[model samples]
Target: MRGVVYFIIVMLVASSLGCISEKIEKPDKKRIHGPKTKKIEEKRQVDSTRKRLGVVSGKWEQLNGMDGGDMHFIYSTRSGVLFVSHGFGGVWRSKNGGESWEIIKQEDFTDVYFYDMEEIGEVLYAGSNKGLWYSLDEGESWTKLKTGFPEIDDGTYHLVSLAKYKDELFFTAVLDKKYRNGRPGDGRLFVLKRDKTILELEAPANKEITVSAKYPYLFISSPYSGLFFSTDGKRWRKILDKKTTNVFVDGKYNLYVGTIGDWWYIGRKIGNTWKWEQVKIPGRKNTNSIFYFLVPDPINENRLWFGCGGVSRFYSFSARGFGNSFFGVGCWNGELKDWKIHSNYATSIAFYGDEKVKTSCGEATKYALVTVGRQAVQKTMDGGLNWSNSYEGVFGDTINAINPIKSGILSGTIVVTAVSGTEIAFNNGEEWMKGIDLRLGKEVGGGKLPGYPWCAVSPERRIEGKYDLLISTGYPSPFRGDGVFGIDTSCLVRGGRNCVKKLIGGPHYEMVISEGKLYAGNMDNGIDVLDLETMEVSKIDFGSGVPLIRKFDGKLFFETYEGKYLGDGWRWSGKKGKIYFYDGRVTKTIYEEYAINFSVNNREFIALTPESLVYKPDFLSEEEIRVKLPNKKYTDMAIAWEKGIIFLSTDGEGVFYTTIDELKSGGVRLKEFNNGLLTLKIRNLVYEDGYLFAGTRGYSVWRVKPSQV
Candidate 1:
């Protein structure tokens, strides 16, 4: 029965196959096709793609590194060679002024100590923890001259000053004598001669001579004995014998002494009689004060400079003119002049001023606005000509978004989705209104969104008929997302009391308002176009690919993973995907979409990811193409258009600026700040008035003004 069934099934299948074959023998007349042109068209497309790739050739110039450390002193020799000694280990030498530098010598023992350097003939002498080391051949080799000095049991020695008096070398060494409890200092002073003979001075017990100087006669100051004078280097005489901390000898042989009790005295030698007069140091009575060093003007002997507050204060003096005092890390013209504050907490000060005027800037200005990481905002007015703190109120610290409404009006806002709240401030950052509950549950379809908000606006949006502001937010989550908030003068004029309306798009998106139409590049969704008047939304798909859109030359440019295209209002169904061409020819393969920013002049556009800048001449006759950038990765850039300057904020370093001519001339000139650097993860660059504002991650907002830079 099984064999009969199998035979019957096989016979039925053969009959069906024969019937289908008979039908296949006669094709339908309507199904007939034409001659092939696909091969010819395919060859043309390949050649076109290759031509596009050949146009853009070179890469961008990489940014130079900005090393960090407190440079305590910078000195230049008579030959115009510059040297900088860090408060830490290294000593840097600059052959060509300070345009470039190289480390010459550094040792572990010299770390974290102030070095007193003096040049005698061609030899350079340095005093550090390891006693006195002399380099006779300009730092080529070193010899330790610690013999004949008091033994430093704990291997600690501090040399405060070195000077040459009457053709004899004099140096002051503080030896740390061991005690039963292992504490330093039984208070000993030593005088070293030019011939390396060390004579120990008999310092009073329980007192230490903090500093010593020579003007042929050795003068040392003690906390217990006012002043001690040694004319022959061994036997010391207690002259004034009042407790003094610092002593200096003037050109007229007048001795100036500063005491620990906040008083100064001057003693003049007249034949056989010495007269002592007490002087007052104004505005320094109640402060922790100590006079450290003094410098007389090279061109003027009557002019004297004093360093006080242990290396912080500076005072200038003259024979009859008003003295100038600098209370902080700044300079002074004369000792009687009023104190001027240059910076809030200046780490270092340098002079590039002329004789008639002395100008000093601080290192703190570097991280002014853009130093804050996430939730940082910076704003300035007067086209970056001047700037003020605008993030004080909003974040109660610094913020990431600094949206400026006008010259005197600014807002600092921060969005943290995890906290379920956002912060907003108006009135130029004097105060902030925070905890604006984003009713996400009632306002939109929400469970728990993955990212925070990033805000941006179109160039056409106006604020107060003067400046323009676009507020944006970005997701702090793993997935990069953005949200944009639109504000007008009416909202800002009301001090942000009015609820500013939100434009369309979600966490990871960008909203660009062009020609009165709002265009959004969505991460999950395709590009969405919304009519400003009717509030109608239209979505254009790049066929399973995400599209990033930018508006240029009065048209919308869309880029996606597949290709590039120019969208016509509603649909991207245009001419297959035309590549950017020069002389009416196709260019290279369109890479994956990322980010872009305009140069200061707006004549050039910089595209991110495999970072590159596209230059298009103002006239159409000139060729247009993309040029690759240096190897360092950059996420965003800000331009000071008037200055022809560009600032790139990096991840590991800080903000750097260069000129547009340098970028075009194949030279990359970058100026990196040592201070005021927030996290390297900068997201946005915006300039308003005279200041350049930057937004960073974790570090919130930072700003730098032209005057400050």
Candidate 2:
């Protein structure tokens, strides 16, 4: 009896092994029988460079505890490596899903951005604001593709699309007419054949372009220029008149187009013509919604997953959007009646796995990962019903403001507020974590003034090993009425429910703490003085609205701005460009007129005007001393008073520094001081603890000892 059972088990095992081998030899021949389906399988075989592994799943945690600002593209390989290109933050890679990430490469050219990426086997290609780049060996290193095109490295080509049609790879770039050598043109499209030769083709316009392949036919969607298609690579024909954002083709050869501000919204190709399919999104109208990207389900061809956002013109004064949020992700199962949407802005989507999983609501998807703009990467398992932020090991963030404590138990701790909210670094920015919990409740405004921590200031005193901070918020809607909140460091460790508390509500832009008073600047209101002893708030009208206020040389100096109000329903006239000096009792105007930014050293005070840099010996002096700078727009300035040097951060020309005495003498030559910086487009600068910290646009934050410069 035992021998008979063993024989039966052996026979069953052999039968299963034979079936597996047979299935591999003769794969499923299921085909999407639609128009122009000839040679579709051959094309699929040619496009075998990308192989997907199992779904990426886990709790949403900071990928390497950093924010990679505005992710433009995301790709994954069968070897389990993930890649993401932050438009300004540079390119990042991860081996273990998103548990951690390391920057593999950044644009050598200043202000250029990597906008799109494509994976072909072990090689990867990227399109950028300037030109094309390629990486071999799984993105550990990269090199620019400068062959064939002579001017590819000129920074004029805004390469927007890198796609594959049939077996040929192609890229499209928008060239600015101002840099096109008097040529009346929009953009260029280049194709890389199997033999590596390049062919130039005419593109519709230089605007946002998306290219997709549907067997033998190729489709191109250009915003504002409509949609075009071609059977051959050289010639194209316009088919649609509406502005389109993206193009997608499913397994059944069905064509779908994402439109921008179109009445027909989403376009679907049916039979031989295009049909408008309106998938009603909740709380959104056709005019305000934008279907950004579309991808077909691998197992369920009828189901389509899409990424969407709102049009730029859609502004909400209500509590929900407060201002505007063009962000959403969802799926449509060929049903116009219902769809699922998760509110977030997604740039690209990739799928993995073949296991069918359904949500409690009966919605299903295999496995998917999406790269959301600014919010970084996210993943979903049970379709679009649920999603998690998979941004571990990613660090493409724009540091808006940075504040460091000088002494006490939290002495070495630094707090940085950025596009991804607030982060606290206990070890001087070596590692960071989510800092404060802004109890933004639920819904649009979250019942509180929904905004981000703009700038934070702490009292010179600490209690119970806890530091208290008066953190100011930014982008406050007029409907909410305030942007100031307070937090204690104790709540940061305990994860308390009310980690942040509202102090004073109103439009405050900048804040400074001195003595027992907190001076806050605003756009609509003048300056707000909040007394810590009495907790009473009072206003100090500085004629126009004060946008900048700082404590320099033991006195307060602020700049007033003349600009129109841009909040929901708020209105303000304007004020002249003026800088004022404020003591605890009195205020006086020092230097007025078109000042961009100002700083002070131990010798004198310097202010950057639209035309030149001006210096004055006394705070109340009328004598004008000027230092003519190069034709570069200075965005921010910082002064290391102890070092007697002033640093100016420009929009594109990196950073320049000079001695304060040289500027006063009117013969100062600004010297470049960007030795260890990643990006030259520094947005903000801070000097603290003998280190000059630069908050850049796409490269997170950098700090260097001032003495080294």
User: Candidates' lDDT values, in order?
Assistant: 0.39, 0.57
Candidate 1 TM-score versus the reference = 0.36
**What's the true lDDT of residue 304 in model 1?**
34
- Please give the lDDT score at residue 277 for candidate 1: 68
> How many steric clashes between backbone atoms does each model show?
70, 13
Writing each residue's lDDT as its tens digit, candidate 1 over 510-557 gives 344544455565544455666655667787644532334443332234
lDDT of 2 by residue, 315-393 (tens): 1101223212333334455443235666655657766555577643244565677876555777776665567766655
Identify the leading candidate in terms of TM-score: 2
Candidate 2, residue 397: how far the Cα is off, in Å: 2.2
Best by lDDT: 2
- TM-score against native, each model: 0.36, 0.78
